[model samples]
Target: MHRITGSHQVQFLDALHRDHVEVEDRVRTNKAMGLARLPSKSWRVNKGWVLTCNLAADLDAWLRLLTLHDDQELARAEPETMRLRIYHLPARLACHARRRLVRIERTWPWAQAFTTSWARLTALPALT
Candidate 1:
């Protein structure tokens, strides 16, 4: 029911279709993050559940896009693998003076990447 374009239309549609496919892939990831089922009877609670899932998704994206952006292996890892390698990786928490210190195990396989990414993340200017 719409007008047709020239040969450039095929290129534009190809790019658009690729983006749509990527979005569908992300939809599957969001489901993995707990968006698959809203397990609450109350509407308010369901909203909160969605919000929490979005927060998790945002953090996952940040870890990939910012922390491991330049790292080939880690960047290509799935969300579950990423969580296992980075977030759930064992670390000793210590309180010193007025602050806390997270001391990751120096023997871990990805310890160097973890420390390098941590340093880069912290070196960012304060969020005013």
Candidate 2:
């Protein structure tokens, strides 16, 4: 089984710090979806770790649409940047999102929205 050591945890902490700096710089540069910080914590679950911001904003939009509510306001808004804020999220959240996406696809039959939302949520690191 995989175990997380202090050093491995530090790497993620460092990434969060770096991301804060980058986000601040982006804000100065007038960039949209500038940056946000995720909460920090220690846990021993799923043989790994996860850290991320709650994507309540995006989820709200989806829920609104599903309910035939006023999604117009949400439509004009840009996509959530929570994924970019956190370098990693717990494996459980990832799995949960994946499962939620599957359910959404089954009920909505709109694969494009689900695919785009999943991609946005997963926002893995870019290759150098």
Candidate 3:
């Protein structure tokens, strides 16, 4: 687990952990309710990377870092841009998945897809 500091960060981390459980439960429930097909075992691997710490701080920092990196890369716009874009992809995907899930209907199929995508995205390796 990541070291959490500050009460707000701790609270956010706790909520994140709880949200992971809730998502897993909802996925199981959807399967039981015959709402959506469960993803394969391979897909489940993504759950391992689900948020264990408060990302609100890290995400804010990442965005700022990305902006700075992007500015520097834009001047070169070749290998640098490609590298920077690849580095930023995971964060972009996570943000997109979060937004998608927020608007997704509570139906079983949509829930399953949302959960699967969310899990897979979070599990993606960070840039070296």
Q: Is candidate 2 or 3 superior in TM-score? A: 3
lDDT of model number 2: 0.40
Residue pairs with backbone overlap in model 1:
none
Q: Residue-wise lDDT of candidate 3 within 14-98, one digit each (tens)? A: 8889999977754453333332333335645434323312243244334434433434533223333333443333222224744
10 residues in a row with least lDDT, candidate 3: 48-57
State in Å the error of residue 34, model 1. Answer: 1.4
* Off by more than 4 A, model 3: 1-8, 35-128
Task: List, residue by residue over 1-128, the lDDT tens digit for candidate 1.
Answer: 13656535777778878999989878877888889999889999999999999899888888778878889988867777777788786888899998999888888998888887898788878989
Worst 10 residues of 1 by lDDT: 1-10
Using TM-score as the measure, the top candidate is 1
**Full ranking by TM-score:** 1, 3, 2
In model 2, where do residues sit more than 4 Å from their true spots? Answer: 1-109, 126-128
lDDT of 3: 0.43
What does the lDDT come to for candidate 1?
0.83
TM-score of model 3 vs. true structure: 0.22
**TM-scores for every predicted model:** 0.83, 0.20, 0.22
